[model samples]
Target: MVYKMLVLNIDGTLLQDNGRINKMTREAIEFAQSKDIKVILSTSKNFPAAKRVAKTLKVDNHIVSHQGGYIAKELNKPVYVNKIDEKITSEITTFLESFSCQIKLVHEQFSLGNKVKLPENILAKVVFQRTNRFSYSEQYVDNLSEKLQEGPVSPPKIEAAFDNNANLSDAKKAIEEMYDEVTCIEVGDNKLDIVAAGVSKLNGVKYLCEQHGIKRGEVVAIGAGIDDLPLVQWAGLGVAMGNAPAIVRSAANWNTRTNNDNGVAYMVKEHFRKQYKLEFLKKINVLK
Candidate 1:
């Protein structure tokens, strides 16, 4: 079968456990691109975070980031962005403040949050450091809700991380129930990502498909994360990593090896080998 697009989730599907793309995975991606398949990264990470990895992989296709709220060709320019309403964002921010967590708002030019304080939890600090190290613009604020309102721009996504899994689950449930206008996705036991209603990695992939005139059946999605389930389920060929959670794996049509085991390469090589042989045979006039 021919695939017009290959949508990969960044954190767990494309990147290995070492937080870098392995040589085999890189070669597989390059091979897919060489075959004229559009390889896109549909991730929950911010544009800069995703762009860094995309550059390393040499994927020139557009990326879907911020959990599908941001679709951009590059970090500097977005083809489309679904930003949360300012009032709704304020309400969500106010609601999340009740929980003991750090809130981060991802904007086009910069990110601002109260969690930038030095005394925040290790996870919060690690997140901040990673963004800073990548040189993604960032700043601090006293009240994110108020500061967000002060500016004309609304963030594409809001993230909250708690120290305890119970509180995080409760907060995620509460937000999902209370904020009916927004979609909440639990990234892990202690974190939740919020985006506009009806927004998701699947939506992002669908948008790209429409723009390119590619049908749903011509797309392949591979991922291993809580937020990746919908995208994986929606693609024509959905593959889940061995390391993916059971739910994610269950959502996929097939399960591949784990990310650390070069799952992306294994799947890609196997999927494209048939097509490659057919083309080679046709070139030699051995097959119609």
Candidate 2:
């Protein structure tokens, strides 16, 4: 089957372990774009952060961020969004605060939250190291629940980070049990993103496909985390990064080399080199 759309996950799936895109990966994406495949970035990050990556790749397609609760062509304006109920958001924030975790309210443009001062917290430390991880500005608020209660808005999602995976897992279980209006998804080891029930990267991918008139069977998804399960399973062809955990790899159709080893490039060359012709080389006005 011919694939028309390629869904990319930024962190571990596309970028190498040191947090940069490799030359081979960059060239492969350009090659795919030359073939007219719709490339969409699906991430747990907010739209702005995703935009930076898109800019690097020169990709202008709609971005799927906030774990798929938010979608937009630009940072300030969202084309689609699914936020948790206002009342529930307040309740959820209140509950999350009790866990001594840093909570960030994820909106389309700016995230409102307090700076995590928990140095002993592993997630907070990583978050500090990667302040640009989220696509929006993080505005710290003392009383997030009160702020949510006072506002006419409920954020698309709330991401809470902890020191350990066990704490996050427990928090996820508790949050799920307490509020049926939202879904708690563990995007990484110690970070949990809470969004409206049923929001996921698969939902984001489905929306993009519908907009582009593509079908599920014509989609190619790549990911390397717990949050990637749905899209990996739904897409016609799912590729897991070699750096991905065994469970995520098991869920996919196949595995590519680790991102550091030019996994994306390998996948593209192995699968598409024969199926699709490269005409990009002919378009350049070369002088002999």
Candidate 3:
């Protein structure tokens, strides 16, 4: 089957440990473009981070960020924004505060509400400090607390990261029980994402398809995290990375090599190249 475009998730799916796009991945994207296949980046990261990746790839297309809470064209032009209403947000915030979970609020603009001061690398460390664990340095704790004090009022998205899986799980359960009005998704073992009801990666993909006049069958969605499950199921060809969790793998139509092993490249080569060749052959026979 031929697909009109490919939708990719960043972080664990596209970038390796060092946060750089691998050479093989770049070549694969170029190969797809050569065949006239559009590549759209769908990520949980904010627009600034996603924009950096898009610039590196040199593709001006749609990006699904905040795990479907936001969709934008290029870096600054927002095509869609799905935010938790203030009532739900306030309730969730109160519930989370009772459990000592620090929250980060992401807004429509690039600005972050509840913006913490620690460097991006030390965010995990800060969480550890809050939990009174040996995991975080004092510097991280100090920075985080300081940032929390200088707050922004309203944000579009909320993220809570914990030091241990048990704590994260407890928080997830607590939120589900206390605030039944919102949707809470576990992104990985250590992080919990709270969003408005009816928001998800699937919604983001559908919105993009509708805006661009592309059909569901024309999309190839790829990812490796739990948050990606909705997208994997929604796309015509749902691909799971070898490194994906068992649940994600089971949800997908096909499993590819791990992202570290250029899994995305392999899929593009196998699917798009064959389609391109068949189309070329058809054109040749028609001309004859």
* CA RMSD of each candidate after superposition: 3.4, 5.1, 6.4
Model 1 residue 138 distance off true place after TM-score fit, in angstroms: 2.1
> Which window of 10 residues has the lowest lDDT sum in candidate 3?
128-137
Q: What global local distance difference test value does model 1 have?
A: 0.82
Worst 10 residues of 2 by lDDT: 279-288
lDDT of 2 by residue, 119-146 (tens): 5547434542234744446677777777
Clash counts per candidate, in order, are 0, 2, 0
Query: lDDT, candidate 1, residue 194?
Result: 88
Please provide, for model 3 over 50-123, each residue's C-alpha lDDT reduced to its tens digit, 9 standing for 90 to 100.
76688788767888877777778754568887687665665665555544455665554433333334335536
Q: Is candidate 1 or candidate 2 better by lDDT?
A: 1
TM-score of 2: 0.87
Provide TM-scores for the models: 0.87, 0.87, 0.79
Alpha-carbon error at 52 in model 1, in Å? 1.4
